[model samples]
Target: MKNLKLLKWILILAALGLFAILAARAYLAHRAAPLGPWHTHVPNELTAAELARSDWTGYLEVESAIFTELEMAVTRQLDPADRVPANRYFDGSPLYPGRFAQDWNRSFVLDPDGPPVGAVVLLHGLTDSPYSLRNIARRYREHGYVAVAIRLPGHGTVPGGLTVVDWEDWTAATQLAVREARRRAGPGTPLHLVGYSQGGALAMKYALDAIDDPDLPQAERIVLISPMIGITAFARFAGLLGLPAIFPAFANAAWIGVLPEFNPFKYNSFPVNAARQSSLLSRLLQRRLARAAQDGRLDALPPILTFQSIVDFTVSTRAIVDSLYARLPANGSELVLFDLNRSVKFGPLLHFGGDLDPARLLPAAPRAYRTTLVTNAEADRREVVARVIPAGETTERIDRLGLQYPSTVFSLSHVALPFPSNDPLYGLEPDEAEDFGIRLGALSLRGERGALIVGADMLIRMSSNPFFPYLLDRIEEGIDSSASGRSGIDRDRL
Candidate 1:
């Protein structure tokens, strides 16, 4: 009788705990910013199976149709109250991508002036357009390689496009881009895969798939910027948070953020579904990596170069070291890790916690792939240098980069890798020759918090790389080398 009574009380407490959690979630959802037309409109993008059957031209046709649908359904149909310059869905907004000289939001092919020596496929991040990798594409073209940057389905249109996108759709689109890149450069030319953020995950996935599939075009090299190897646990259960959206009163619960879409080429708003899909992709990538390692299929994988921030909030830096790089062979892969600014002037004011210790983030020297840490030459000064530890070697090699960290900036961000200091859009010192309506990276606003429409984090985050010249030089090392051969400084990684 006493045991039965205790069981009944336990059930009662569990019910109460569940109620409190759900109540808090609903309260937060109700308090979120109202959704705009762009959030509500879902684009009719092709599915994974459909994309599989389509070639480059067919994929472009589908993309064209999706944009037409967005124009008619989202932009043209925006209510009068929703017509604000900050909302990208507004037809008259100066931030409209179409108003620019070149709409980098679409999939594009850049051919070298002469017959291409090699080829590359560039993939952008989640909720990002091809604009993210435009600089890299141009660099490849300048080096006589055909560069193809594809706009994955459910991106480059509206934030709502991400609401219905699946990981397979992106996988199929990646395959299509590879096919186009190979076709443009001929079958004999070397092929490289370059991805940023979520694109990094896709690039690694494609290379792994090529190991098993004979029909797919194998990449001679892969380069990843801020790759998503592991992510926060929240992503695993992001779908559950939107469960309340099944009810009419809690429809807004489906979205994690519904901020104004001010950026011309990228979506400021994000949906719950997008996070769920990313989580799925990251999990799948990890599984494949493990399986490849166990079955000795990892040797078939190609060399990879990854650029990562040591203290990234978006993805796990440890995972990049443990999950992906740890599995790599002694192939010519290298990891360029950008460490936090350990300047003495900023030390007392900075709250980086344990991130100040760069040693803890990476394993000891004599690693399988090359490990390069771009950090302050000395903690007391802002001057930077590269400390490289080659594969299977303990000694360190230091190279002066002739660069300095901006005192105001604390560290690099996940989105800051591909862009340069003078990039017109996201640069810290935006170019005088060009403007993308706004120079977001150059803004150094100071005021009381909550006064601005956007969050302080968005304004303060470093959007462009000050050391982009070094990054470009490193990339050119591969481009200028024999298209079929790997780099001499091989510390194989991805």
Candidate 2:
């Protein structure tokens, strides 16, 4: 009996020893992995100030004033070249210069001596500031690249009573950010542009504008997330395109009111002048498409990767598919469309159904569906759009410039990207709504030229997890394919 007891104790000790070794290996491996949505690399070799503090009370009042003044300046400034006009004027310069020449205190991460793997210039969406891309900038730093997140004028402030910013001002901001990124990266480093929503559209515009510049830096790639390149048909009649350019002072747009769908971002009202600016931008893009269509310059556009959600109510998928993606040069650009409704499945070993799963306390698993993305067609036009509609909803038709555009349409949602659960880091008290910062960061790291698309849910989940390797793989694949002169990417991997 004594011998048997000793044997049992020995076996137990052996088992425990094995467990300890395995656990240690797993922990080390995880730490070595890239920082991403599901995992974070602590980077023991690198040290920076930890941002564990959540308090911002010290700057609350000051920030409020800054916001108000900025908005007021945007509201009152009409001249494009003038930064915050000395006097009130909504109809200012038709072309605005960049604001990067001005200085402000913002954090930056840099690899001062490296040959610079690449430089990425990030532009935030409307009503947002460069700060929104903070997490994204951090991710780029981990990959040994230089990244800049720029603050857009008329953003990060109290709502400017008048929405009057023009597309020129926004474009200028993009130019400024890109120029700064290029300058910091030096001569040999390639430049890549990453933008979200409105910023994405501006990036596209900048790419087009830079085509003829002799001093333009070689562009490495372009990545757009939930890009707001298109607007709904109603917007055409409302302020978006109807009255702003022709009559800058005219303001009779009721459709500018915010919708409940916008509640996710906590914005209650859409600015009037901002809507007018959007109209101007949309028109400019439309003109570009028209020129490309008639003059055969479509091939001159840069290589692009754009992410879009079929279910996004904020921007019209139809416009993106028909006007933007479909208009790309057949040999240069491709679109990655995600089926938002069919996104989440087998979540952490649980398969939930429907749009919302009460048991999971999260939206239902995205239905199981194959992507129908394709771009090269023999016809003059090519489209790659997918839709996922629940029962009882009529499909909306797209109207482009008083004529219907030939398109491929499908069902999906705006928030289908894999966003990080706002509280995923917390044990049980997760925030009700997920945050897309990590996912956007992951996408930024992973994107390549020729257009990449993702559901919003995927974007939110990656902010904290920082899964660097997975994203690096995607980037590698894209770079490899681009080098091989491959056109029209295969959609199976997206």
Worst ten in a row by lDDT for model 2:
37-46
Evaluate residue 302 in candidate 1 and report its C-alpha lDDT on the 0 to 100 scale.
77
Q: Considering every candidate listed, which one attains the maximal lDDT?
A: 1
Name model 1 segments beyond 4 Å from true: 1-19, 351-356, 484-494
TM-score list, all predictions: 0.94, 0.51
Pairs that collide, model 1: 333-491, 333-492, 333-493, 369-491, 370-491
lDDT of 2 by residue, 279-396 (tens): 6677787676667667776565546666554346667666665666655554444444543222122123423343232222212223111112222122233322222222222332
lDDT of 1 by residue, 319-376 (tens): 8988999988998789999988889987776566454455776777778899999999
**Which lDDT value does model 1 have at 85?**
78
Off by over 4 Å in 2: 1-115, 240-255, 258-267, 330-332, 342-419, 422-494
